[model samples]
Target: MLLSRKAWEIDLREARKMRHSEVLGCCPHDCQDGCSWVAHVEDGKVTKVVGSKEHPFTRGVLCAKVNDYQTRTYAPDRLLHPLRRTGAKGSGEFERISWDKAIREIAFEFGNIINDWGSEALMPLHDMGSAGALQRRALMRLFHHIGASRLHGSLCGQSGNAVAAEGHPISFDPETLAESECILLWGANLLSTAHHHWHFCLEARKMRGAKIISIDPRRTRTAAKCDEHISIRPGTDAVLAAGMANVLVEEGLADFEYARSAADDLDACLEEIKAWTPDHVCEVTGVAPDDVVRIARIYGAARPGTLRVGIGPQQSRFGDVFVKSLSALAILSGHWRLPGGGLSIEGYPTFDNAAPECPELSPEGTRSLHRGQLGRILTSSDLDPPIKGLMIWGHNPLVNQIDAETVRQGLCRDDLFTVVIEQFMTDTARHADIVLPSTTQLEHFDVQGSWGHCYVGLNHPAIPPLGESKPHTEILRFLAKEMGLDEPALFADDETIARSCLPDGFDWATLNQQGWLFAPQPRRDPASMGGSLKMSMGLDGPEDLNVRDPIAIGKLRLLTVKPHYLLNSTFANMPRQAGQQGNPTLEMHPADAKSLGLQDGDRVLAQNGKGTLAAMLRVTDAVLTGTTVLEGKFWWTANEDGSPVSNRLANSNWTEGGQPTFNDIFVEVTATSGFADI
Candidate 1:
């Protein structure tokens, strides 16, 4: 037996297989591009993660935040086990605990809360931390089973979507951008937010002589590259879109034949636009009347003109109005008849799947709370049991939410018991009573739907759980069994869920090997539906165009934008990513800085009725005279010296569509310590 050469060769083959291997996965972060990636594992450790070269949409590209993902997974400060708070809340002091003990404690606390205050007292809050369908839905299945207060998502205004329904919302494939004649980046910071889409836009510009225009309050990175940038006033996007609609109709540039065939309310929309003349729009929007006419002509004359809507415009108090206005503009342009000639809102592809939320398990009339009002929900007397137990995952509200001070106060309550599932001790995690370690994308099984392009990705676990950490599904499974609950859905295997999410008859093993599959774009055009598009113009008269606020004298509209290197608070802690972002600075127009008697690099305080924030100033003309820009999703501890976070001054008020009005905030700035010594 010892001399058998065939036995030795068989053993060597097994060793070679184990030593080097590649696992397919999808990027879990909440980004427009749900990129497919390959994890190279050597000796049971992930050596590197690279974008899949075979993915048509990803094209072997990964954003700066995710290119070095192995570093993030193996970061020194990554949480490796369950822990219990050992000091005051928000102190970041915790002691390691056993997995069995951790599960038992959670079971006991959750049971106690339910018995004392009914299951509605328990609230589970989450955001798009991981866009993977399984990771997002696992905890929801547990919460629904327990009849906890449901979190009504606040990522966007559904009211705006409801208005979009009047006319079929057709999101043409971004790949078709190569065919577009005129591309209007309306409120879309594509170069910063969705860089993949910008590739196609650039191709159109260079290949077909396409005209690109950027319409925004600040001259964003995308705007800097565009042929023209229209610096419109904040909250006036609806006015500009309405003006363009008027010009399209008045100048006889509108596709009257297409409009009559595709839209049922064309006559009514005509009446609405009559009041939104170019001059009146200029008075309200601060855009030149001639520029409005010119842009309108460009869009109207092009056979395949298109518009791309962004999250920025819908964060205003009248977000629904903005969506409706933009929708009307596109409908009147009659661009949907051709490829790349319609409004493009990033959308997820549909799949044959089970209900991730398991709404069927929820009790009748279970209370639902909005995420925008988290502070109010926790502190309000109107809530009967008042959120006794809060479980958080997939979100860091303290850094991302509006009214930071109020959220802080709510988290600091002694009576409240909070459980946080995280990979790192984020600002919100530090305040939790129990911190459970969670696995990174490299250690999980997931499926992803792209909001940026038409592709679906598969993720296979590349390595075992690093320590006592587990995937969201495994964590929930352990807790579910510990609590003596027996829901079939709660115990479903991750691979099964992932496989069911794919199209029927798709080969799972083949998909795992290939990394991704092309999801064909659906036909959403009105002509295909055999019906006319019916939509409200969202404006009635001059009064509807007015967005001016009678604020305190020196107040300027504070515009908070997303950083290019960070997705919300996800990569804010990485040294390399943080270094790229540098210190957070408030950008003020030269005229505004001069009016306030301040210079660039000066330390200033922005205060409003809600709260105040401190930051260094950069005097630049990128912003308009009456506005200031601060781009970030920085952690609460971003400033090493312990200063307030950027969202402290944001208004918690909801938009007309029930979304956070982070862009509608108005604040006054004053020199705090004058120019920094450096």
Candidate 2:
């Protein structure tokens, strides 16, 4: 195979004697902060990686996970060549094969599946594994041209983005948080998930003496450092927002003039929330009445404040309502009038409409499949033509998705043809009939947009494809030729795709030198945001509130939270990351632990109708009374002792939009010495 001309081909011994040179790049993982990084290469070897100091958002700082990216790129276990399965599925046995043979077999098998079971029988499962527009979208062109079933909606943030979009909420630059007088972090755990965004919040506290408040079910690392933390029940965020609005208006603290001018449905919203008294809200949300009143007063008195809403709370059954209600609270408070005041929800700018999904290229009227229901799609009996072929790239559904066991069972089918493209053998990859080695961020060329901030940065190839590994685009190009597909979108060169996706006026040369550029902001007039308030006013109390709270009076709501050591399941296999993350533990309140006769560090099994998981107990007051926390992603199903996977207890339920309801699960805890019966 002919590689890129810019590829590095020097040996390590020769690299050691050469001077160091810096190349600008962007982090191509599934992160809100698409951090700008500088790779310091000595001849051909990357000695170290650091955050780009010139970038406005990154500001010379990177998260702990990306700080040691070189270790992951050069890990000993990375896949370097294509392999074909030679043993039973999930046996992790494979024999090396030439690239030409691998592509030919995949094309041939895909053609057979299409001819036998119809085009819809072929489906592709993917996500933000590679956030680069070129890399993430390149594979879709081939699938679209072939009329394969499409993966619809995101595994995360679909509901929130949909709800936020309907209201046309004004979004201010995140860097302006330092100018605010008050900041409310609603469901956002910045210290753990978004360190760079947290840095700006810290600047508000240090430079402007801004009062910061946290509202969540647990006292997270970010909440512990805030001025005050308010613990509340799960799935009741919308009601809490309504209560705050009631206090603001009823107590005569609301700015009537500003609210009237900003939103046309001010009176309608006021009447709708009149019955949501502080006491009634406290009963539903498990928050103190006085605490709600205090937060309302603080929010009302500030001239300019920011409401940073995280996507966690939006993964519930009524997630869209939660987002709409919070957005309404910002409207009633009249925060959009000031420069630093507005909502900070995700709105990633589309650089090029042509590169990403190429939704237009798909054969007209093809069936769309929801990603949250992967298990059902693979095992369902109602479909006219069942899925016979699955192409997975940049995503590990077996560990990341709910109902993982069902997905594993589907993959074990002898008739199903599975293909996986990855750098390492993940749990999902182990079940594949064909495994293709893919290049890392250091050996790829692409461009990416940020969710935490507005910058869109360029990614330069820092080194050559490690061994026989190839970029995702090149792999698809080879397959397209083997299949005799000649669509223009399928054959677009990597450089052409990358250049086309740059922000409106920016060129490749200037962006490469500057490292990053801020995205163009859209102008939104607050007076025209009346439709948002109208939607919020119709949000009556959820009917299922009472039934949703107590699963069985003794069961606890399971919260599988994100971990600081890994991004989804990306770096979980690295030795350094594995040590930092340690063993997964079940965090429960002391009262809850005592009721189950469980002690700290004791082995316990959390069981529900869906599945069961074994983890060490951690009794702490940080979590709420009827809630338990289990953090981090999974690399495999069980340990040598037969414990179940972390997502075993999670169901494949979805929110009102198509987002997964990962946190809307309940389980009962029991003491166990070992998982021998698992």
Candidate 3:
């Protein structure tokens, strides 16, 4: 019963049968918007999937990447059965194996590793690939029982939340942004990433005539629609923020009384901003002094203006300072005190229900691995008991991690017994000793929520597990049985687990009946969190740690941004998404292209001390003269000779907040082929 790879639509018979019922579910991808969705199921097959129009924020619209999600579940290349590798690692060779045998092998290997090198050698790697409450966390429970090493870091690659939001990530009730007089979308491509929220921004203009400004180095689609687009230099977000504060205080637009109540050392903050003159800011941020002054005056004068922060700034050398500086402007102008004038850095941890209690089996001193530094962690020789069993679930490290070539090399090690739980045959899955098929979101039962929205979602099993794939809980249960352990917690079904994680006194039946559950939260004024405004940006010391005499270091700063079509390499395997997004090109300013004797469409090599990647050059003014842009996690697009794709350009050096400095890299560009007519 192999499905046609090219088939894009369900047959009439399947469709008619599925029309009888629609199951409620939610998209479990790594997006902040955990959009509630409806799966039209007929004859045990999902005919179609669509967003819930009833869901307030998603509003029935789905992103292009997820709109064709049914195709992904039924993709011809989907790993339908358990596979045991026969050829070399990363060779894409395997034979289908029975579930019992697969589980037995995994158990035996894991037990051997624990017996010989202690449980710490058995490393479990998991992340937000399947973000359902009972989906990804199922693996965590098992690892805790085994005492495997802990993975403590974020692949989101941003520490702005820690820097700006006073350690509590809050978005100012996105629904209230429409009342704002002005909106600043800093480093966020709202049109692409936060598409749904863009509608509210438009409404703000119609309702209140709010001025919308986009601050980015590139004139992104969102920037094009913005009333103003201010191009700032890469890694220089802090400078502009400081300069804005300077003008606000000097022009008497700032609310001194509000700052006095909310921020400690208010006078010290004001005195610091006085030195951040417009001319000094222009030199560091690459923005015209006039534009800087104009934006500051417009934003500072507006009451209850909203400030939206994105993950882009966290990729810089001083992302913490950059985000803190932006957050401070709200306090300086007393904008946080206004209804629509607060800041929304991120909306994670909005859900009040997360059960952190896990059975502690490992010793207290087990090593903790940073998820971003997988390459360096795997290749390191200083470990007490070297990582023998590497189990990757819900994350594609080969394509997404820093120094991916090194990750590839490390995965190929014969001594490492690797296991990957996945749906598609990803780059990381190809390197596994065993590939275990996992159920798609439509075929799983779980409770889900969103960081972007306040609605809770119910993911009913629209159909039975696809092919021989099992739901996450079932898989873990089978493994526990094979290992001869009968922990009642391990055998608990999805319903039981979901119920346990729900907020106290929450009724599952009622929540499902309503099709959504709204979080219990009263609207909070920003001034209520007095003295919690993160005043320190850590700017008293070295701000530009990456900057050195240009004579020795690479000149151009590198920024690998999220692709408009791909979601962290997940959709790269889809023809519709991957085909639409062709080869990865390095976009550079025309001035820099001319200086390097390069022309548009020329094959160029971008090299830094970390690694090098080759792509066709695009000479455009969309990028700053001293910086280059490359859309990332491009794994499906492969070169003839095996090489790293997107992560090749990024180094694993983290920021002050344990975030990957994906954008802090500096690269030297050279024309690999025919030169330009310089």
Pairs that clash in candidate 1? none
Candidate achieving the largest lDDT: 1
lDDT of prediction 1: 0.81
What RMSD, rounded to one decimal, does every model reach? 3.6, 4.9, 5.3
TM-score of each: 0.93, 0.93, 0.92
Lowest summed lDDT across 10 adjacent residues in model 1 is found at 542-551
Q: What clash count goes with each model?
A: 0, 0, 3
User: Which of the two candidates, 1 or 2, achieves a greater lDDT against the reference?
Assistant: 1
lDDT of 1 by residue, 245-280 (tens): 999988888777776776778888888888888999
Encode model 3's per-residue lDDT on 293-328: one tens digit a residue. Answer: 898898888877888878887676677777777767
Task: Write one digit per residue (lDDT tens) for candidate 2, span 139-189.
Answer: 888888889887677777877667655655635567878878889999888
TM-score quality measure for candidate 1: 0.93
Candidate numbers sorted by lDDT from highest down: 1, 2, 3
- Give each model's whole-structure lDDT: 0.81, 0.81, 0.77
Residue 328 of model 2 has an lDDT of 74
Off by over 4 Å in 2: 1-19, 165-167, 255-268, 347-350, 523-533, 537-539, 542-552
